[model samples]
Target: MTVYYCSASYYDNCDYWSTSNCTPPGTYCHRGACGTCDNSYYQCAWANLSGFPPENSIADTCGSSWLCNDKHAYDIPKFSCGTVLWVQDLCNDNGLNVTIADHGPYVCKCETNCNSVNLMRIIDLTEAAYIYLEGSFSRGHIPVMIQT
Candidate 1:
């Protein structure tokens, strides 16, 4: 149970740190040289199922509590946190259309007219086939929205 997000005037459960810090006793408010916000969880790093290196967040330590699992389920240092990428599993290539149609954001690719000259390469974050992302742990703060 480690969620730590502080700043609700002083984290006495200002809400949204994952169901009020697992319902318990808290008393930590410091948020400076590192953090403390009247305590409730905040010790990141661990959610690297062995494939997410590019500097997304990996320097862990902070424990109190935080957990959320829609069903695929996960909580506890249970491999840290943060993960979200479900564009139907990266556009389901099987049909060979990594992604293209540019006019509305679906211009992502790893192959297929993703550039033609074809070697498969064009992944700089572009998913607008209606845009829908929620894999990054998603507790709040989500903005890549493009609804047209």
Candidate 2:
């Protein structure tokens, strides 16, 4: 697996200088409120299988047709359009197979819903993934093991 880090320094200037979310030096800006940036760590790995949910209800960063049912987003480097991933919820030993359809959880200097309160979070899953794993989104963030 390949590991990647979102630079804290990149977020510092963007978060402090702009009243709204501004594009970082090397990344594109998506949907966000003012003074927000995503500063998180990420990685790439292998996948065992592919799975799809009953409903594709979320829009990704690119505004694609189908997302991973639970709105799973990816880091810029990891967003390969149709890449598959197997993610496990360390909190409950549950897992789900999903695809990279969006970009996000931008780790910024300030804390926000982007990272779900867990600064270590690399991938952001929507309600569907959480429900499939029988996890609570209110937990803010849960530890996870992901297989690309």
Candidate 3:
């Protein structure tokens, strides 16, 4: 039940951002512009899927493979993360800012991207896609203290 806040890229700086109908049960997340080989044990495998759909169909309804994309496991969420903070602290902080259009709850497992407005979709998946956990949740970033 642990979680952490992953770092985010600057607003609208994506090399070439695009959108597609995710239907449901999925979303799109920006791993990188140049499509870096999301940390591998053997070696790097960066691709150049600047404006293409990922692999996991659910993540991106377009099914439109990018000229280049990185590996992934689950459907990358079509999320516009606001000034992300420790989910725990998020509950405590009263002065928190939720003005960023890039921040919000998040949509997943999209099938047609119709209902999920403003939510981006990515559909790139691979065997070594699990590495995404690195961007999952950190220790100090959130508010989950380790047990002594």
Candidate 4:
């Protein structure tokens, strides 16, 4: 299912579209236009698959040898390999267009806060991508907006 996000409120789920008098399900009147949410995902971390053993490498999902070197890279769930996405960081207002190089974080690490595990986006970015969006590596994770 395609995810639709609204800026005026917390992110919501919507699907498909029709012409006249048509709005995404679960939403009121079609707002003419819908944009990505500022906080679609509450957590984003830099992916470092290269640090793992060959058996545990993300490269097995997509044969992108440049995942370690490429600053603009992505690893998101649901999207197919090679799918490109236009992403923007809500914190820094930085935008990036990149291709999906890996598929992961299937398990949300709720060790710290299991109360809101469903809110996690499970997105993983390359170190360069994270830094370009003004994320602090020491912090490990940051809230981000993904432009669909």
Candidate 5:
């Protein structure tokens, strides 16, 4: 996964710059925006629908025909629909086999962690899949490595 770090639109002038979060290794920052300093991927959490109950009821980008049952559906930045992703949740030490069903994280920044690649939630998961790895729906994201 390629992670890009950019300043929140609201933090327009870099006033809220955080050295550790904004300038981690292998990242670039300028004018309150940052991006991948290197092409390598890092281990980080990805956002999930479990945090937002309303999102759990929506259809995936794959199509209206696709069903998000059995915790098998997920979304990533730009993978083609139907691609299989073997996800290993780092924090929970759990693994799940999911498919790319949509496109999102439309923004890399999360509520608690902002402009930080290491804390970024690169992928988006269905509520069920998230619960499978997290054992609960309290967190907005989880750390995972995606195996194609």
Candidate 6:
């Protein structure tokens, strides 16, 4: 598996669009727009995936039911879902164990924050995880080292 240590962000599962209204078979809805799935597993181009109850159409995806707790979301790819990961903040040496909850970094959208000379991957954390790592939400992004 590809391994790299990079920056990290945070996001909740609350923001998402329904795929039920999506017209094409290869696409899924996200943030109110229709986008193509990356593969048969329904992974979106932006890295988001489909598979949530109630809407049951699509979602940001999660590592476990507990990680979905609005405050513990981690937006790693689906391939990393359910995996225990170690993350250490490069700035302060603060670290914590996290699960791959969701998929993203949305590359283009995150721009320099998600990708840069020092930043390679973006691992979004939930409010709870961020707080646990002593991070400030206003900071937006933090440099971190992620390992499986």
**Winner by lDDT:** 6
Q: What is the TM-score of each candidate against the true structure?
A: 0.17, 0.41, 0.17, 0.41, 0.43, 0.49
Clashing pairs in 5: 5-34
Q: Give the distance in Å from residue 12's predicted Cα in candidate 5 to where it truly belongs.
A: 31
The clash number for model 1 is: 18
Candidate 2 residue 94 Cα shift, in angstroms, is 0.1
Task: Give Cα distance to truth, residue 59, candidate 6, Å.
Answer: 19
Please write out the lDDT profile of model 6 over residues 1-148, one tens digit for every residue: 5344566666543233323555664244443222221121212121333342312211323333422213222434344345556777676778776655455544422223323334533456655676566546777777666665
Can you write out model 5's per-residue Cα lDDT over 4-123, one digit (the tens) per residue?
A: 221111111212232334556423343211221111122112233233332432223233343222221243233444556677666656877665443334343332222223433446
Compared with the true structure, model 1 gives a TM-score of 0.17
Q: Which ten residues in a row have the lowest lDDT in candidate 5?
A: 6-15
Instruction: State the lDDT at 83 in candidate 4.
Output: 47
Q: Least accurate stretch of 10 residues (summed lDDT) in model 4? A: 4-13
lDDT, candidate 4, 59-109, per-residue tens: 343344333223112333334444455656554567675444443443323
RMSD value for candidate 1:
18.1
Tell me each candidate's RMSD, in Å, in order: 18.1, 15.5, 17.1, 16.1, 16.8, 13.5
Q: Write the per-residue lDDT of candidate 1 for residues 53-102, one digit (tens) a residue.
A: 32331112212222122111122112212222222222222111112111
lDDT of each: 0.21, 0.37, 0.24, 0.37, 0.40, 0.46
lDDT of 3 by residue, 67-140 (tens): 11232313232322121222112222222211112111122322221122221222222112212322333221
Supply the TM-score for candidate 2.
0.41
**Top candidate when judged by TM-score against the true structure:** 6
What TM-score would candidate 4 get against the native?
A: 0.41
- Model 4 residue 16 lDDT? 21
